[model samples]
Target: MDTDRVRLCFYRLLQLFSTCAAFSLVASLGTGMGAVSHWSMFIWCFCFVITLITFIVQLGEYQPSLPFSGKSFLFTYACLATAFCLSASIMYAITYIQFLPHGPFRDQAAAAAAFSCIACVLYALEGAFLWLLFPETTFYFATIHGLFKLLETSVACIIFAFISNTSLHQHQPALVWCVAVYSICFTLGAVAMLLKLVKFESRLHTFFPHFLLGQTMLSVLLYASALVLWPLYQFNEEFGGQPQRSSDVSCSDELPSTLCIWDQKLTVAILTAINLLIHVADMAYWIHFIFIRSRASAITGL
Candidate 1:
């Protein structure tokens, strides 16, 4: 095929993959824990709407000479891909706590986690081609897109760490303290970056690489290591034992202890397995990106 046709094929592939990812995300999140925060609902709803808009816009028959700017398409897909990946990671991590043991809930959550993994892969594809579609694009939107790419992985690491700490909050309040510190650092870093993005601060630009490399990478690995270590050894006992108050109070029967134990174990297993897949994908992404093209690394030095 000709060059324009090849590019159009990439566009079509992106829209198609993005659409599938969007619908899959909806299904996974809708039947999830069912107690998602309002902000979580809003973020997912926004992702669903935007991906649909992207699909529809790409498929439309009529357009001016330039239907949509390529930069606009890049920005839109970058945003959608980030949203899908971020939200799915959070859902996968958080839903593990809702398990009820021998019932079908753990099974459902596992299935949802699997679907979210699929969606994350698809959105990654969408992000990859956004760059392939325009190899020479640089600055602003390009940097924003790259930042979101990092955000997907870093944010997942943060979620994994935060929840791991939160899971043991009762026993290890000190660990929960780490969550507060990390969250503050992440928030402040994000705000500072946004200001730099707007004001185009040269001084911050010089230090941005250090933040992305040293600070952000270390923090991501910090939580990721904890997540790997925790479930590997301590998933079973993380919930601690039931209270003797149930017997002392009377008129109360605790959940079947065996089944409850099974619930926690299964949920931990599922979450850990999902996390392994994501880390594998991230490693593969790093390798593929570093070897396949130097331009991406030229952007972030990763």
Candidate 2:
């Protein structure tokens, strides 16, 4: 027990250090920020704050005082943190670090992105260690379906970040429908995750699995439509989109800062396809699980 406590404490401290270092590096960059920088900064600050609170809570062994299961809370937090940090690192690096002139600012930005990745890995490791340590502890999000839920939502979030204020869906009903599909599926997955975290899914018993399966099926259909419509509209010349990327000067500017609209469109399409695949896998798992469950029940009845 003492050894376990030491291990957890060391792990938490490492997470805290990485997050804090990332946030501080970003904060020290006093000027010339853009939308991506602001978003990355927000992620770093959020991670730092939450990690600090969690470290304190765990150190004090205050899990029993929380309204929800502490293990569930930690598991969920680690998963989300890993996703958020990875997204931040990727976005900040691609949008800022990759474009900045090789200098102190670029160095700092690169270091910050590196720290964010370190934090992401640490959080993922923490989640894995927790699972190995407490295999018996049940959290719906810890299941395969639940992990899919996390992936779907996380991917949707990155897609949203890429498209926000960019007007990638404007002036076309097809693109608008794609946006709607993303919103609906993201909401469904997010709400299901929230319910599980709050232990509300337990109240519904068998109904919860059906609910999950239904929503996953709905998401799969929605994403399939999005997968088809998004690329077709964005890449099809009939929709005023070029079949090939244009050589716009702004896209290749010396200080290419923000993501070009073309890049955003392509990214959204790719992420849409990826999320569609995840939802399909999620649907398949639930279907198989439900079928096996029913078969077992029928055998027991006989």
Candidate 3:
């Protein structure tokens, strides 16, 4: 198979894994499953950003834009690839601990853990692919992404464990802790992207647009999953025991646990369905794109 084709598959599959993980995360977060808050709250924000970028890229293809640059696209790709890998690894650990043969979400946790692992592998491959394509700068993106994610995931685990304690009253100033950590991570991700957005806009198409054609579709899936999670609550039962939302990860006086019940199992299901569709669409698009390009080159060579 062509390198492009392989990348197509890797990305689409990563989308599926990412989406399913998001679903479980959404449901888990919304309902505050197990000892942790739902994974959706903090994560959905990142997913939304990813979706927006994907949409912008899609629009750029049809309508052309001053922002189209090979360097920029490569940078965007690197940042996302970094996030995806980190999310996969952390999510795997979180779900594993959440279920742990001793928790109520065992089945869901197991499935999610598997997806996270696979997604992690794909992103690692993606990082490698990009390294080969642009060996000089891959390290910068990877390191930045890794540092951010390491902080995000590690803090999340600590925060989740802290909140999961049934004796929430003991963890004084819980609200402050959660808010501070989440704010820091959010700021880091945003600053990194803002810097990149500026860079992409400045540079022309130093990168081949065709290289990423049909590629941004998977991000759409993530966007869809993120959107659907906001109002869709099918897993309300899991919300009872969790700490109050300091909006998402911490407890506050404003929103009591009594009001935190939001089940998004249906949202998870929808994301899974979308993942299947993404996989199929990716396969179809890349095959067509590659074959057509190959044929054109063959004819042109004569």
Candidate 4:
């Protein structure tokens, strides 16, 4: 078996594993019991284990090629491995802490804050990689994307801070405000990044249909899913309570609760569909990059 083929196979396997892990995490949210939600944890652990194994195998088998040194590749592998470990550990700790007998809201908020911080770090590293790989052309785009990610994560951090400080569990208005703001910012950033990608395309429009366009589609789907989930979570938080009406309530004074209109089942179904669509788009992008795009690049040496 050729080493290159083996490496490619491992890469594809890793991608599949990552896709499964993402889906598992989203699915776990729908489970009623928190303990039963550990399936997502197991999926994450499995991904890390496979990633380590793949790294070791590829390191031993592959020889250095031009454009980057073996040492640089090893450094990248180390950073990625460390980031994944940190993310998993923090997530597990947060989950475990959330189940404590006298757990405070701050504990849950801390977990989210920690996750957001780590995500920002990972995004920084990823942006650095893109800059290094495509210095002249990709640097500006990478910088813009990284800035947007930082802003997005910062919003999460702010929400976490508020959750930690305030009685967030009881503050329905605050929770709604946080979710709405976060969703809007995320959507706008995603759109900006997509536009950047579109503006960068040259003459390969017909061949690739713009790589960023597919990414934009995925981003829009994700944004829509987030919007749907935001209000649904708010509805869940407010359900079974005396319906709070705003100052603009009509003279009837018998208006139906907003929760009734927010339909959890429909929201969950739409989110799930969007998730599946994003996964499909991800697969298509990966296939196009690995096979068609790369092969064409090699042939044309462009």
Candidate 5:
């Protein structure tokens, strides 16, 4: 009815359409494309369902009945959808589209990738619109710390997807350790985000900040170890791993049906390094907050 609501509705509709189109394309392919296709399908379907539910809740004015703030829920979900859909698009393109021969399959995969990308952009726009149009609240994800937590979780999800093939980590104890590190950090990050979402942080004072600082420090150390170990175990010749991508048959061959172990290993290693950097940055922020900013605030009585 109002302009803001109207705009919101428009964005939701576009997101729904794009996600639907993307998934439909994937579904039409009938599962021949392998893990990437299934992963892409899951992302698209998840986004579509969540968007539909959020749209319905907003339209029906059911915010009061919900456990969380509806605006915060929508904004957070939009950010998540954008990250997931973007990853899905990229994964689908990298694993399938580039390898598929020129044919109907290739066209369908490309179309799905395009639609996924469109949906990702729409969700980003929706999140931005909500942020700009509404007054800022104390939503945890809106803060820099919260956003970094979300990024860490999202990147972990992508790494998980890439490493879904057991061949990359199977029989390799070091790579398994990297997976454990990812799991630990991802679990901690998700729990932190959920606590903030449920407003549990407000109930605690110094403990939560201290918890965050500890969590980040632990995450940094874990990821740093994983960053070095993953590449070392994956690329080192002495480890029975290929020294170059071209040396790996799956990666060197053209038009492979699925992503090669080399690619997955490299992707996991690269993402591990990126997440290591993110954790480092997060650690620095928490250290500064716990030591400098909080002390200054207490001293000034602000």
Candidate 6:
């Protein structure tokens, strides 16, 4: 089979899996019996499909007559694969440690075990890829991304460890912590990259295609919104945890009890809206890159 054909196959498979997962998640929300369990299973299946497709695509033989060498293409593939695996690993880990055990399904324990094992393998592969493809010019950006991954992976590991020791699953604190750290790191790294792009804007036309530049800008916007949304969600969660007022309290003495709920709901709604926008922008950029832009520059010819 040709490389392009294989790539297309992988892309189609990912699209299908993503669609099914979205549908299953939405459906699970309306079910009363083991909703979390069913949702977790769907997500696990989604991650496994994405990870396997990504790994196969990364390993496919592609011979391009571009200015860049094959090693550059391989490095880019590795970076993308790492990113996919990181996301999959985090989702799998959370589902296993926090959702699966309390699930009513008979196979929940087995599913959790499988997810844990997969997460370990993905973590190892992500680290190896990072070490192999560390860029010289983008050292700061790479370092920040690496640190963020480390923190995220650590949080997953700690949550698993806690679950093992206590035989109880609780992930709110870890989720809040991971999201907070990821938001800060993403904001700083995106800002730094944006500044670099601005400094080199005069030469952008010479070095990059217009479509690619636009796609990069869209990616920046997506990351920025994600960074903002993470903190907003965390703040909402924190505030939502505040103590409730007693009904016996006098009206004059009671501060507006509804205010807290309204504030939390407003923050959550805003974050959700921004997140949806980010996803839309991400999809648009992905389509532009896949169809219109040349693949040569996409993999920075190290």
TM-score of each: 0.43, 0.88, 0.44, 0.33, 0.92, 0.33
lDDT of 4 by residue, 1-302 (tens): 67544544454354435534443443443443233124324434554565556456555765443233433333333333334434444443444334334445435434433543443354345435534544455332334333333334333322332233233233555344544544554455455444434443345544434454454455546555555544454444444322332422321335321212222223333443443344445445445655786688789985
The clash number for model 6 is 0
Looking at model 6, residue 154 earns an lDDT score of 32
Which digits, one per residue and each the tens of the lDDT, describe model 6 over residues 1-302? 66654654454455344434433443443443232234344444555565555446445643443333433333333333344344433443443334333444424443443543444344344435444544443332244333333333333322222222211112355334434443443454354334433444346644433433454355445445544544443344453332232322321233321122323323333533444444345445445645554565666654
Cα lDDT, model 5, residue 73: 80
Summed backbone clashes in each candidate are: 0, 0, 11, 0, 0, 0
Candidate 2 lDDT trough over 10 residues, lowest sum: 246-255
Off by over 4 Å in 2: 1-3, 30-34, 59-62, 139-141, 247-249, 252-255
Error of 6 at 155 (Å): 12
Against the true structure, whose lDDT is highest? 5
Instruction: List model 3 lDDT by residue over 41-120, tens digit each.
Output: 24433543554455455435542454445444544554464454455346445433443454555566555555555554
* lDDT tens digits by residue: candidate 5, 1-302: 89999999999999999999999998888766766568778889989998899899889988899777777788888888989999999888888788788999889889999999999999999888888878756556688997898789788988988776778888799889988999999998888877777777778876988988888899998998998888888899898777898888877666688788788888888888888888889988988888896788789996
Clashing pairs in 1: none
lDDT score of residue 40 within candidate 6:
42
Can you tell me which runs of candidate 5 are displaced by over 4 Å? none
Comparing 3 and 4 on TM-score, the stronger one = 3
Question: Which should have the higher TM-score, number 5 or number 6?
Answer: 5
Clashing pairs in 2: none
Q: TM-score for candidate 6, please give it.
A: 0.33
Off by over 4 Å in 6: 1-60, 63-110, 116-120, 126-141, 145-302
Best by TM-score: 5
lDDT per model vs. reference: 0.46, 0.84, 0.43, 0.41, 0.85, 0.40
Evaluate model 4: give its lDDT.
0.41
